[model samples]
Target chain A: MKYTEEHEWLRIEGDSVVVGITEHAAEQLGDVVFVELPEIEAVVAKGDEVCVIESVKAASDILAPVDGEITEVNEALTDNPGLVNEDPQGDAWFFKMKLDDLSVLDDLMTEDEYKDFLG
Target chain B: MSDTLRRTPLYDLHTELGGKIVPFAGYAMPVQYPMGVMGEHTHTRSHAGLFDVSHMGQVILRGPDAALALERLVPVDVAGLAEGRQRYAMFTNDKGGILDDLMVANRGDHLFLVVNAACKAADIAHMRAHLPELEVREITDRALLALQGPGAEAALNALLPGVADMRFMDVATFDWQGHALWVSRSGYTGEDGYEISVPDAQATAFARALLAQPDVAPIGLGARDSLRLEAGLCLYGHDITEMTSPVMAGLQWAIQKARRAGGAREGGFPGAERILQELADGPLAIRVGLRPEGRAPMREGTVLWDAPEGGRNLGGVTSGGFGPSIGAPIAMGYIPTTSAQPGTRLWGEVRGKRLPVTVCDLPFRPSTYKR
Candidate 1:
């Protein structure tokens, strides 16, 4: 698992990575009411705002952790956005992207490193 | 290293209940609790939510000429306000701008006034200056709590009976555990609820007692703002500021008929001429409700234009957020008088994207107040 400073997390699976926000980010954003995702086949770079997660408090950007092309977007979140708050890590995965360069994954923080960074 | 923020009487209770503290209006207030903003907001709409509103200013106006003196400052019919009734009013400046909006409750012997925390100092000073002979005493020895929702009356009446008998906007004094408790059957959420003024010494215990009830939970300021916004109520600094007028803010209904032209007490208040003129002829800009086309919610300062691509800049969104009860994103803002009617089409520039929006009526949701 890889995490970005912006509180987004990614998991590698074959040639693509599954993306979603961390539990901490989900908790910080009170209630998840709406989620705006990037279109499939859209190319995104690291630190680019590829999606938006809106809560009752405010709307926050979900930045891409690595350069990739969007492969799949979570269609279920359109009807039930609260899934992101309920299971931020598992079923609530925001999107999947095919990686352009595999070396960028090593630049992201590990799980333990992200914990310390949060503290 | 730095001065600490002021704490209310429920500060310890808030921390113990896992409330997230934030600085607001010079006081450290709880923005949300462990239940989160969404939970608190839904609970307030369904059951009941107890709010620690101690930071708001509570004042007592006493004197034989208090009502007459107050009418000179506010544009409301203070002289006609029946005893034990509450009236929504605002302090207008010389140029017809709103200084602060407030609630005035006539308690027979004295007037109980509640003003916003940020504008409390200025409101009190303005009142004192205008009514020099009248006694304007700021009551700091009390803590205010609002028990609001559909279950509010049942939960409150379990301890103090007959509170449910009071009509909307009714104010009365009751004895709670041998202490004088002032309660008004009114709230900002457009729900039937009560705003209780309790002694500071018993505030913590009283709050805890309310939480022990079946339907009461400790809601924080975050949910409070969302709830009020969904109810289409105005926030002082955001919606109606010193630069906005009561007429432009769409609060002219608050001015009683007697306070307007050709009434018993006609045009005796500040900015009366301008307010009456605007009443006869519409104002330059008016506050209206804006409903965005899609799911994305617009925030304050989002530039509104007449056309989708680019047109004349009409106005900007003042307050916008997701309304939990309505299950959609809603907003309120000021637009030109020409496009203020409901169903008028407009476009909002949000995050560099031009989103289509429709001009709708105020109050995204219907009020459930028991009138």
Candidate 2:
């Protein structure tokens, strides 16, 4: 239900957060086969290039939604990258980042809003 | 896009798994997923990567003397090809230009051919016109999936034993959950893997079975391109085209001695005269490997320039990309044969900026396949 203008979503999990690509971003990317995630402990800033997602025609960078430190990465991505395509908002979580400013989420679009924005 | 589209047998599975399907080679195929190509390419190189390649044409050529009949159309020393040995070869026109490249295997009396999906119909027509006596059957009803990577052999062997015994350029008929298929130890990715060509009706079941394996997952065409690029393989339209000859492309090695010494490369096939002369005196332009200076990609059509003053535009990049293996950007293009040497410095014009480039050896990554 949560969303970002960059087409990523953060589903809360206790103190940590699970992030995945938005369905819109996944649809735009076509079929994704490989996902490159940032290493753990890698510090990232808002809008910084944190990771990469590759589709057939183009390889896109997944920008950081907020300045924070990468606490964990989805190791499964190396073996099963198509998970992002399966459930962009669910199983395709790329990494977990502690928010530098939780307020950044407020600037992001909601799931409903993002769906309409595409129109 | 219109819903009036042709779907591969794995269509439903692709949608369920969230594959981003796109039109390619006349079929709606998964180009990428959310994870992307770079990760997928690396994963497949390190592990196993699945690919639905049903779009490629799987054909069977049958006739009283199919080998003799096919020899009139292409050059690959077809007569000497063993029954189960696969060959990477080309179909040439009367003048020696390549019509298309294909994998031809002698399956006993008949020939089993795997061709590019985009050129299937034209290839069939060309073959028919040249060898009318032979019967060509399009097994388009079948679907193919390429399982490539370092761990590919073990993953496939789990389901079908004895499959791992086949070496590169080898093929064998196997039974998959009651469906028979022609599985080849071959792939576009320079990995030890298998290309399973199975009946369409059983493609989904086979795909499901493979997915059940812990190390297996579906890969899209996106990774396929990058991996092949890393392996320095050529794409049909971009690298090898009808306008380009095999000799110029540095594919003269694929031409058998019997064909070249038998006057086949002399002029029998279309453009053979120019091609043979190019082989003798060397081509005016040669296809050479290129590595760019920076992270920015220099894709096809990026013009090449001779370095220093008074330099001329030598050629254009036919294919370029950031290779995960090389950890840098790479490309290939046609340059003056005189300047086509390893370590030769050149320039690649990207958005009008001249980036320093250098000629490297073919293939940015060493192939790990058991060739």
Docking class of 2: incorrect
Top candidate when judged by TM-score against the true structure: 1
Candidate 1 chain B worst ten-residue window by lDDT: B1-10
lDDT of 2 by residue, B1-371 (tens): 45766789998998888787888876899876555676777888888999998988888999988876777777667777888888888887766677888999888878999999888899999888888999999886899899998888888998899888998989888877777888888899888899999888988988988888888878888789988988888898889888788888888887677667454333355566676677778888878889876555667898888974458999999988767667667888899888888998988886556878998888888898787
Tens-place lDDT per residue, model 2, A4-62, is 77788877665455678887788777555456789899988878988877654556888
What's the iRMSD of model 1?
Answer: 0.9
Query: How close is chain A of candidate 1 to the true chain A, as a TM-score?
Result: 0.96
DockQ values per model: 0.80, 0.12
Q: Which lDDT tens digits does candidate 1 get at residues B1-371?
A: 11477788999999999999999999999999999998899999999999999999999999987888899988999888999999999999887888999999999999999999999999999988989988999999999999999999999998778899999999999998999999999988877899999999999998998899999999999999989998889999999987888999999999889888888888777788889999889899999999988888888899999988857899999999888887888899999898898999899998888898899987887777878
How far is B107's C-alpha from truth in model 1 (Å)?
A: 1.4
**Per-model TM-score on C-alpha atoms:** 0.97, 0.79
* lDDT score, candidate 2, position B278: 78
